[model samples]
Target: MQLRQMTDPNLILFDVEAESKEQVIKQLVSKLAKEDYLESEQPFLEAVLQREEVSPTGMERGLAIPHGKSTAVKKAAFAVARLKTPLEDWESIDPTNKVQLVFLIAIPTNEGGSTHLEVLSTLSTNLMRDGYMEGLMATNSKEEFLSRLDIEEKVKSNSDKKYDKTVVAITACATGIAHTYMAAEALEKAGHELGVNVLVEKQGANGIEDELTPSVIEKADAVIFATDIAPKQKERFAGKSYVQTRVAEPLRQAKEMIQKALSNPDGVVEENDSEEASQSSSSSNGSGGFLKDAVQAVMTGISYMIPVIVAAGLMMGIAKLGAMPFGLVNELHEAKYATHSNELFVILHHLDKFGVLIFKFMYPIFAAFVAYSLADRVGLVAGFIGGAFAGGLHHTFWGIEGIPSGFLGALILGLAAGYISRFLNQKIQLSKNFQAMKPMFLIPAISVLSTFFLNFYVIDPVFGGLNVVLRNWIESAQGTGDVVLASIIASATAFDLGGPINKAAGAIAIGLAADQVYPLTARVLAIVIPPIGLGLATVIDKYVVGRRVFEADLRVAGNTALLLGFIAISEGAIPFMLRNPLITIPINIIGAIVGASTAVLLGAVQWLPLPAFWGWPLVDNLWAYLLGLVVGASFIAFANIFIRFAMIKKRELAA
Candidate 1:
């Protein structure tokens, strides 16, 4: 495995000329072919090009390493080039880098795993040493250059280097070939130079190498996630002080990243220390930065809330259905006053109470996660207290029960708790010994008190006042414009799919249902209709139109949309909406309006804040709800298919 045995001088070129990235690659790949190391030049060339598409192989200091793993390679070999003119057009990890030296490595598919490790351990190690690359460029002859590489000292000076601290790291890139190993080597060397033991795990093409054990992770002082994708088993480093960055950053700034991790080994990641967690994929449709982060937190809250909503809704629905056969639907709707004598009926009554109790935690879990996103674990206590008050946790005074603002209370209080805790952590000056007090004691106290005051004085009064005004207006107006109100709210819910309008629509719907001024019939119907309708259109496209209306990729996306629709995430329809905003958005809005208004006018009353089929039994008139839902969804599905097909036909005729 000596570097000298791997190649001959004929493979190394000097004073090379290239105008583009492709030209340079072609020149190098031609050498591998001429040397009979490759079975096919074109196939291997395509392999290298496909690797480049994932992420460029360029590094700082005017160096690029383009590599490929293919069966077309007869042997594992490499070619080097010292360019006369820099390849300015080459895409690089560091955008400012213009390639002056290129190393092209070819590995046979059979020996890919073993050879890649050997190539990286020997070649990448030498490249990390100071003046190693400069020495390569300075050599006048190929024989002299080969001598310089071999004659260089091989013994490690860091063998005697003692370490007191340990930093665990995970390095991964898009291809998990070049940049991944380079970053790991760079961190290990830098850690050695700094007198620290940096244990690294490489998640690469060869699979997990030097995997860190739980024992080692527990003993480590800090963590570094150098990855382009989310690192596997990230929960292992949950409480550790950490830094997260792209895979290639360590090739240049390895020491700096390590030092920051060492200094803050007992706290949440500071804003100045590293970049924020990669944006949540759910928030891709929103405005970026703070707004995106806010939406991400909300989505996280929503994700946790789903199980609670589904379980509670399903249990309640089952209880209601079971009681219908015995003429005890009213008695078993709530367990508070169950008059049933039979053991079977008694169990159903208990299930009804359990479901009602479980529903109370839905908003709390939502708020807790939202707070976790903003302020980490310290924000949970305040989130629960605020959420309980927001959902009206039954503390009565003067014959009035708890004043519940529902989602509005949870949203406001959760955000407040997160920001306040984050601010306190950053602003409060603390000695080294007192750092533990910030997350455990100080943060929870201040956050909970703030939540109590905000909920009691401000949020409660406003929502309570609105509820009184709405109750009066609803009773006086009776059925006047009931469908109009439903139409407006439902339309807004699907107006932009998962954008701001769509997100805020939930709160508005919940607000209307707080005091039963209007039932949640419209809101729940609107939630599932658009995504399910759009999803159905794609599935039945060929059947109805005698040809596939959507492309191959979109057909797959439609199946995903259909699955997500049952879980009531409107984001499933986001792709369709994005593809034809004018067509899809308006149609979605109209569909939601029709579904909501129809459900409302038909007397399908739903007082609870739940969505999807699990909530169907909770509706006062189940048949009416189903009928309205079918009518509205069918309109959207058929309308979308015919309009898009006609448009396609017109384009075909013109062609």
Candidate 2:
């Protein structure tokens, strides 16, 4: 009913003395075990470690909220520990702050989802004000600390009464500690102001712990799910009032979703049905949808793209490996693994060509599926029309001395198909028999016709004109590099996990792959380097710059994703940025731009159009890729060091 109702004072440790954040965390967790707050220290600690491996929880204002929702928690509990000395956590770039303040919140996923938002909102808002952290640090007794918390809670609770409608929400960042908690607080504050009963369920690396349980779901008017990672167990809210969004948006948009849901309490929008439709379409076509749809589409797309990218990337790699001896053409006859110019070699070459052919198969499929996710059956036809038209446009524009507008064309087509399908779905009607036929006849026919004409007359010509402008711009861009451009692009890439900026870059690479003109390996390497570099930098600088709480997260992020990065995967870096954007993005951007600029300047040409793989050398200049790697890696490492030092300095000033 109230914050203290859930918090056990026995679990709270004030003026807790520990040398570092990790030692303090372990001490606090072990203490929780002693107090019977957790079933055992090991499971709870392991969850903390495991989750942190994926994401660090070091938040703004020299605080570390390391939490987990796992089997380890015997009861929902909160503990506070004030370190005698700051601890080194992996994700903490500001070395000065080390984690002096640590809050270890434990909850069982099954009991209720962890109320991470409540804890974070309670803590973050208190920590944010000028003297609140100093007040916290100055407190010498549990009574003093409790008093501070009580005061903060009173103010927050009063704010909660302002909302006219009450809403419960679940907020999760991949790691579950900092951002999950912060977003939770944000939503709560908004709910309070709007007079809503806001509850948040949190899922973090620690596993699912104390949260708004099934009862909460059953009682609440609606639920808001803000997460970047896949939720562990989602069956509880099957038909409940709910909506999903990224973790950060809730502070601003969640209140609105709650308002809408409350206004029409019985009219909650469930994405599951639409998600399934798009996934089915993805299996047949390529991929499509908003976050859920896109995720499914991407999964399907990757499944389809893998064979082609592998065969092509490897063959091209082999060819590059043998480039000198074969003198390009003659080497086709030389056989190392298999006889070249022999049936085996010819067959392999044919497979390589087939792989390239399959690579082409992905574009239309991807475009169509994307449309399908947005507009269902009608979207597919429109998407196909758009993709096919884009292909033709590429040939006409770039191949005809007009410069490539393939990326622009594909985007337009996908959007066009989605809108067309949406329009038909809204305006078109049919009888029962016609409804069945509608998908086959009405949706496809009109969609295709609309897509074709739209692409032919409007999309093509618009991009055609834009291509001329873009080409001139690119030409002028030579020797005109600016730091602002680099910063803006890099920051945008790091701002959201797999959001628009990520897609834009990915779309460009995909366009290059489709053209068969530019090399795929080069583009993928550039894409892959950012996450890898930042991850490594987090690892390398962990000891000096991060708190122990963050080290757990960095270990997960740095280690779990490193292998994936070697073969050119970008998703691996998502957790790092998801938890701490302000700190993570700058470091990631520095790494990405360093890699991209270096690769571009070195003329690191890719012979094959494929995703990243290490067994084969896909690029014409392997060293250039390595150069990008080094530049990216070094930039982040240095950034971590410098940033951490600045944090240390700031803390000293405050102290």
Candidate 3:
């Protein structure tokens, strides 16, 4: 939970003889591996590589923290190395962007608790000192190097003196990597140099690392998030300093950004001018550039919306089953009741009767949050209007009453609210007296009014047209009832396993889930299969190459991956990819596509999204689903064996 707790003195390598940056990384990682600081070098190396791919670890002012989450890391660890010669790496706020001091942090992928944050925060605060990094780099002895950080003071939380300065910050980027950490460090360093103790946090693929403790955060003058990724626990900085920006500006114009944040606590920054901002925004959105914000916004919305979705979805599932046992539908429905008897239905029935209303309205709540992330204050009203419109439209189309669009309507509605609110804000003017009323009254009122009318009139007709077109297309595809198209989609869906093709399939599945036509199980499986099945492939052929992954590290990754796979977690694949992407990716693709295709042909029903219900098996046909899993897993295993053999042969040739 503290920085020193994770730092091993033995892993601290100073005055090393490494010719290249890669050599430095390998030496440190190999040492960690040999010392059992990590489970193995391959996973740690892979994590480092993966992190590199996302964003370079090099920071401004000659510091870099290249960190990753891995099952290879048995315990959280800090591998500190001060380069004897300056080594080149990706950097933020660096024209050359080379690295000298490298801190490779290895954390267990499962340590999702505060441990990750603690390490990140500790490093940020300590390294923010202007002399701190130089001191470490200057030290020839390992003892002096670790001592430079004053690691002991960090361990004794009570000994630290709290400096109160309003330190504004930002965290944003395309990959959400190097710049995120660098900008935070720059700001923290600015505070430190200015005699202000600053606490900075970063948001990245690995999650929020180095979060300033609440005590530290509360005592701070203010906080700034220069990030495209949504800052975790935003409400924590409510009363104090808070601001948002694109990643680049904080690094490019560090002092200016900090000064601006200090000046305006509630002010919002659009770093449209910075190259980092433009590049990042472009990468995140692509052709549908507007959608770049959409993914993060929706993800944040969904994350917040999960508790509601789970509560409501499960309640309804229970209620439906309960109604069946009570003869609410028919005794024939009892056949489906093989999985659950009257006893289970009894619990479900109560939930349905008492909790349906709350669950039923979950979509609207979800939409509201999504809208809020986009258009801020005005989005709340517009989001609700959009959700209501979608629900009403569904009712009108099917000649049914009270059917909620759930996440689908929420998604569409949130987007609609965002656009509408943004447009309205541009058109409207705020009077001095009515300033307080902007977020509270004017923005919401106009946005809601505009979105409601548009969705009811314009959006409904569009939905009807699309729905008809889709139904017809599906029927045409299934003309002979062979489900060939569905099978093809399934195959394609699983082909690449988190690659471009895989993502495309996932998008399509998510779209179907929104439409209520595709079962929740299919979508969940699509998400789960790549990570899980790849894990399975690794487990099945742990000794495929004999020397590559046939060890304790592979076993650890395999077992952890299996657990994550059953739960439909994508993180499970990370371990295998770190060890061997060449083998793992291809194997994952085969399994994912085969399983998906078979499930499509078999028509397995997925009732809930990945969050609430995953890996239950047999909603449509448990045996059929199980069969698909076997086919998929086997395909990947065989492919991996071939790839691993080739890799071994290549290594032998080199040797």
Candidate 4:
């Protein structure tokens, strides 16, 4: 089918008002769905975003080509949107351009074989032609615009021009869709202008094109390695002078990069292990490809947040355990703290209070780092602001004294801040003298304000309402029976290991405990059970199956998990969940539920922050608590082992 067959007038939106690139994509994707171009919008949207994480599609002269391959798309199509406000932080190869136009292409993940390459190639070539984009901008009607998509020849270089220097270049990208060709065309165009003979070997999804022979490499004076990943056969240029950069760098600086390669940039070609060094230099030298994935950004945030969680929990645990001997600890009967005249009690009370203070900023820290991951230092201030809102810092302003949104809130705000700050940094055009104001003043102020607006109108209200509903349910659940309450809390805690859902459960349970709704017995035990259980399973797997069931590294993780579990850190079990999430998650939930329910039925009560062994003395029924813990952990351990053994036996029988 022709390019225009994929685009309907209904899919072409004009004068769309959106502040960010994400909003624009969603708006267009929604339109595509309304026009029956997609079976579902979210999966396709996610695919497009995944492509974005690999490398931003924004190009020079106010254009962005964001495409995705997904089963959610019923048909391959292109949608165009002309935005009223230029999206600044779209991460266009040319950082200076504010993206006013977007070409969002949807390719069916399963059916996008050659059709995918054809669409991307046609669009990329049409864009490369002289005045193609400018012509589209002048079109007032959708039909006028659609007609522009007709087949067109690529902008040609002067073939008759003579050159003294010959540069052989390689262009590659993670997707190998649009960028590979775009970079090649840019290099050729630059060579034509500079009177240098440039031959490009494209390493793409379709494999290498215009393959470089030994003769070409031998004759060339310099080489340009423009790629996101390591180029194939890089050793061919080991002894030759080379310049390394990312794929998109050529879009804006093709001439400068070609010139630099001719100069033989230092540190790229070292004496020892020169090929490896050159490859490493090429990867590191590029400013792009640093933002790996959204999940990685979240994990990075979680990693940074983990130490804070552990420290706050440990401090609170110590204070609770220390105050127990002197009868200074608060119980259901006593609403007072451990602020007794004894110096130790007073010190412990102060420490407990300090822990609460530290816990308050946990969400904000999680958010700030996540933003830092996505948008670098520019996202820090905005992320911190968003996280503070997520943490319910404006409780007085909102007039709601309940639990904060916790991890979920932090994640949302962190990502939002990163996108906003990054966008403003890229979009806002400033002159040389005032450019310093962009990052130091303009970006932070605007991003923070935008984040505040989002939380004020949306996040706080929604989460606060959810909190109210959750609190009422907890009170109602406790009225009927402790079993119901314990099961629910324990299940939620074990659900995602250390994900936002776990934090959400923690927020509600801890808030209720503070208000004396129910003891923390279920919450604390549930937190420890999964890690301990997973650890035990790892230890017994080989014995149960007469062969190693898990990888060697998992066994090491098992040892660490066992120790961490005893100390009430649920994050230690995260490795197991990540490896086999579908089975592991359900098993963990069941184990936690059984353990917490058993503890409740046996009258094991603990309302304090002490989740570790040190707090056993403070528990109302220590024997019942111990039995429940063992029963839950053992159930999880044995169940996991049995399932693994069955799988192993089945495989052997089949063999």
Task: Identify the candidate with maximal lDDT.
Answer: 4
Q: After aligning candidate 4 to the native by TM-score, how far in Å is the CA of 13 from where it should be?
A: 73
Which of the predicted structures, 3 or 4, would earn the higher TM-score when compared with the native? 3
User: Candidate 3 lDDT, tens digit per residue, 102-135?
Assistant: 7777778888455564565556556554577667
* Clashing pairs in model 4, backbone N/Cα/C closer than 3 A: 70-109, 88-427, 89-423
TM-score of structure candidate 1: 0.46
Lowest lDDT 10-mer window, candidate 4? 274-283
Q: Estimate each model's TM-score.
A: 0.46, 0.45, 0.49, 0.46
lDDT of the structure predicted as candidate 1: 0.71
Sorting all predicted structures by TM-score, with the top scorer first, yields 3, 1, 4, 2
Question: Which prediction has the highest TM-score against the true structure?
Answer: 3
Q: In candidate 4, residue 118 scores what lDDT?
A: 75
What overall lDDT goes with each candidate model? 0.71, 0.56, 0.56, 0.74
Deviation in angstroms for 203 in model 3? 9.9
Provide the lowest-lDDT 10-residue window in model 1.
Answer: 277-286
